[model samples]
Target: MKNKSGGHRRSKSARNEAAAGNKNGRRRRNKSARHGATADDGDRLSKLPNDLLLNILERVDTLDAIRTCILSKQMLNLPTMLSQFFLSAGSIPGHHDKACLFSCSEVFRTNNAVARVTDNILCTRNPKIAITKLKIRFILMPHDSLTIAKSVARAMATQKVGAAEFEIRTEKDYEDCSPADLLQFAKQLNNFVGACWDTFAGLTRLWLCNMRFGELDIPNILSTCKLLESLHLTNCDSGTDSVLQVKHAQLVELQVDYGEFDRIELTCLPKLQRVIYNYWCTYEDPLYFGFVPQLSKLNLTKTGIRSEKILELSQLLANVPSLSDLHLDFESEKIWVIPECPKLLTPVLSKLQHVNLENLPEGCDLAWTMFFLEAAPFLKELCITVWDHWCIMATDPEFRKKYGFCQKADVNWKPHVPDFKHKNLVKLTINGFQPDDGFMEYIRNILEHAVNITEISLYDRKVCGSCGELAPEIKDKVCPSRYPQTDEERKQITEGLGLASRAMVHFRS
Candidate 1:
């Protein structure tokens, strides 16, 4: 060897030593040494096995993943391993702060990483199991206007990605965002969008809207997401052609707010339990609206509809045997003259225990109570809002204002023979109770007849308009019985009533 070359001839160890290269090569050599094997040892130790790696990632949240990326150079690409990525923000990053905190650029990169992970995991020649749940939550200031769609599509890839839950919540002032983004997302995934109807193969929940949308689009979305168990759609617009046909049998809860719909039919869902429609503009009744028998709770507030619609809804709602809670509040500055709310007797309300009828017309309390009693015969609690007795006496022109006394007409008189033979009655609360014969009689009847009664509350207005005078008769005297004991109690009650009266005036105006 010395004769052949001027330099020393390369030996096996020398060649091996020369081959030992950068940090990665040195680490490989070290790993082999640690295992007590040859440098060419095929058996390699993995930081995490395939299954275990996926399992560990399944437990780690998105923030923790980002934290992990900073842990070591080895974890630099670990974000690509996760099928689900969540970016949660508490408050919108202000202008001075980094807009990149939740900027479109960051989301774009994150979404690209998510896509790569899906392709690697799901499209592998021998693809492993796909992720079942992908949840992306944006809770703070107006979600980056463009964040939702990219997140949704990354969740809805056709070949392998399964069920996904997307939640985007923002304050009411993010007006710059458009509804087209949502519509475009749905339209893009129209094929995968039918996941809800396929039983266990679809989306479980979808909460969309801090913006407005047409009604037709919403029902289509609902129909596609038939397997959806809980759905919340707010500030959406619907058209006459738009029909809400809930065809899924697995839906449990639905909340639709400030929308308009032409026909809402629910034949596909058999397991639906609750529905809340607030400030909606729809007047169309579902073809077989009340045929379902398993629903439990319903709230329809400020839904501009004819009296006949309420009666129809009530009749339909009565068929459900499991309903227990009901709230229907329709109030306005202009008088709403509608047929009396129908007496509901569905098995659904058989166990109803609590009811709240707020902002009802003044003289409707007795009739409202009667309607409530007929529907929820088993009711144990009720709340009614009306003007204060003292306020009426002082403010009503019909009354000789100055003292706490009001004429019958000034009181919005509704003659009623108060009786509580129902026996199930336990607690009673009357707001705006002033010292008047009608008011006194109402209170006395509840205390006298409710044998099971234990607690009774009477709140009076802060300003007593009745000049503290009576009609001067034994039968009509209001101060004869059951009054608060101290000035403090009286003042507290009066203050509460006064505040409540002011609140009503504010609400009504």
Candidate 2:
């Protein structure tokens, strides 16, 4: 009887100890949860591998990366080890917009910020780690520029910099500057580039704005950049109405925005893969494609037409057979691309996989877009966004008339391949969706033709760029979306479209 009593006492003691341990574990887990992570997770984050920590820091600005990891000493060391650095001329405190560059003192301060940031980073970096990429954008000032160029030159000499980029800007915006200002800006920029030939030669990318260079000036600049891969020209050209010819051996991407050129002829760019041109109307034919075998993506955005010609895609992309992505933004104006016969378009769009048509006018017939489905047999996805952007749009009647902006008209079209069946179209997304006859009919027609379609996304019209600063008078300009909200309405539409799975149709609330 004494032995049994002793065994019972030992068992009771063991139970009490287990209950105490459970209470302690719950307390620790609850405490960790309050900090938005478990204790184990916090330790793991602090002890992450060096490569992973560097990858996280490299995505943000150099200053932002430092602030995020302010608590971790190990993390603080990782910023110096990042392979790529993108530094911009810091903006003014109250004047974050580029329009504020008109202030001379503020512009000088911005230039100083660029020099200050570049000096701090390049001068005190970890020399053992090779910098693979470095991009710096700053205003054009002789004094500050000299300081920046010296720092970059020293860093390049000491480190194995794989690529460098520079974005040069002036004090005033392109529209705000006079002809004399533009000419002077061009001279300053030209001198800057000339002085930094060694620095620019190693540049993989370059961006310069508000420069009116001579006919041979741009070509001479290109010659100095022997290893340049990407060139961005903004509001720049040789003459008021001159033909700009580009021939670069190593150039892979070209972007021309608001350039004052009658026509741009890409004579020979062997490695060019992407091209983006915006707000160009100086000539009937905005561009002439020449010897760009590897070109796969092209983006063209135009607000209103000042040219005398309607663009034909078949002819524009006649040589680009490897094109996989094409984006066209009409700025809610007249549609520029001509829907030609399938035979004429199929060769140009043969390997095209993705197509995005943005800012189509609301009243236009969606049937005109069917031309792509019939032409590009390999197209995998098609997205369309229809909206009239108000903020940037010209609303004054007199200004609209001067630019020849016409009334919103429908583009008449009839499918050349009336019974054509698409086998590769996998998804369709429409942003400006409405549950009306026109929309429903178009969707039903698509369902019938796209036999392998899996997902159809419908979303309300999204205000791009800025939605916060809306004028009271134009607040009602946004058209209310009529997308079905109730589950029953959605079900009816789903059944009406004959989709087998409700999961395949998505309605973004």
Candidate 3:
């Protein structure tokens, strides 16, 4: 009996030893599976061609591209092979956390990261590989000046960057910060400009925004970039009172938006094909365009036209003999109320094909429209967007009270009757179409005059949700439709006017 019991105990111990071995084997298999999975991922990434990897990196922001360098050995050099680099504080990962109330510590950390990343990129990048484009946008801080300057200098030093953009924005509005503080930031930009002029020999496109010019002559600054093709200056301020002048031989496209200058003169832009000028603030002087024979497209947005110099616009149009597409937006209604003046010899735009006019004030006669239709005899398309500030005021009670409803007046002034007939006009689009007396007269004039008109598209004026009360109501108010035009109304408009039988009128909601 004792022998049998001892044998049973040995059998139990053997079973226990078998179970322990099985558990150890399972652990070994699991660990191997985990390691194998990681290796497979790494191998897949490493097997990709260098060019393919570089293409992938270029699509992301520079900060994200840099982060991939730590992911695997294959991606370590991918950032260096990129042809374009875009570095902005807004692009930094996790930097937008509570952005509006960003703290000082967060700023310090972001600044350090920016400096480190930029320095590493400039220093580690292969000299043979050329960076074709570089853009940097950041809020200028006191400690950020030197680092940004160095980065810009390093980029320009390559002598191969074809397009570059640099923008310095403030954390707060200009009104919130003192002028001295802003000037201090502006001083740092001078270093970047120096680097640009010294090394930007291959640059073709350059855009600078929100930077202080500080008595620096813009014309002289642009002269250094001999190869620049497109230039855009937005909200750039200069402390000097001198009229800003731009003259570039190689420039093809130029856009100036909301500058602090009193006047801007464009002279000797021989190759310029397109020019966009947008100014809303009050200025006594007029914009001057000179010797741009190749200019084909000109867009003027929110430009102020003084009551006295209305004739100057006609003279300015004489300079661009080749202008085909013209867009004009007057700043105020005062332009429409000019007094009786002697007939001026307005230049004819024989090549003008398309004309777009925006913010056509109420109660204004169609004299301006007549001016263009007479000048552009070959106009193929005309689009007019009517000005209705009442739509905006309907949203805010305070604004509505401050700026009362636009007072309607009788159309008393008669413009020069044009003997010219428009034969080439095919399409006309009028947005914000109200069936007021002025609009009716405008449409009648077009239908009677444009002999070859093919189609007229009329769109109801847009209004905010708050302005529902002020919107025009149909006579049959039971349906409660906004901008309802009945079949009877269309019949009346088309019957009297000698509209072409082939011409179709469309009313868009």
Alpha carbon lDDT of each predicted model? 0.49, 0.82, 0.64
Per-model TM-score on C-alpha atoms: 0.51, 0.84, 0.69
Model 1 CA deviation exceeding 4 Å by range: 1-86, 89-134, 138-164, 168-201, 210-226, 283-291, 303-313, 316-318, 329-348, 358-367, 384-420, 428-450, 455-509
Local accuracy of candidate 1 as per-residue lDDT tens digits, 1-509 = 75466877877765776687557657888887997787453333234565565456567666656565555565555555666545443233221232345565455445444433333433332224355566654432222323344434443554355556655443322344445644443343343333323421356777655533444555566666656788776654443346666666667887876544554566656788888877644444433444456676777666232332333445455456676776665442112222233233535456777766544433333333444444455778765544323212233344333332223322122223345355666666655444445554554545454456555555442233342543444224333333455666555543543333222211110
Q: How far is candidate 1 from the true structure (C-alpha RMSD, Å)?
A: 18.0
Model 3 has an lDDT value of 0.64
List model 3 lDDT by residue over 232-339, tens digit each: 776665743446778888999988776666666788899999988786343444467788889999887763322233434456665777888988775423343223
Top-TM-score structure, candidate number: 2
Residue 395, model 2, lDDT? 70
Ranking by lDDT: 2, 3, 1
Model 2: residues with Cα > 4 Å off, grouped in runs? 1-59, 63-82, 92-107, 306-308, 464-477
Indicate the residue-level lDDT of 437 in model 3. Answer: 66
**Residue 370, candidate 3: how far off, in angstroms?**
2.3
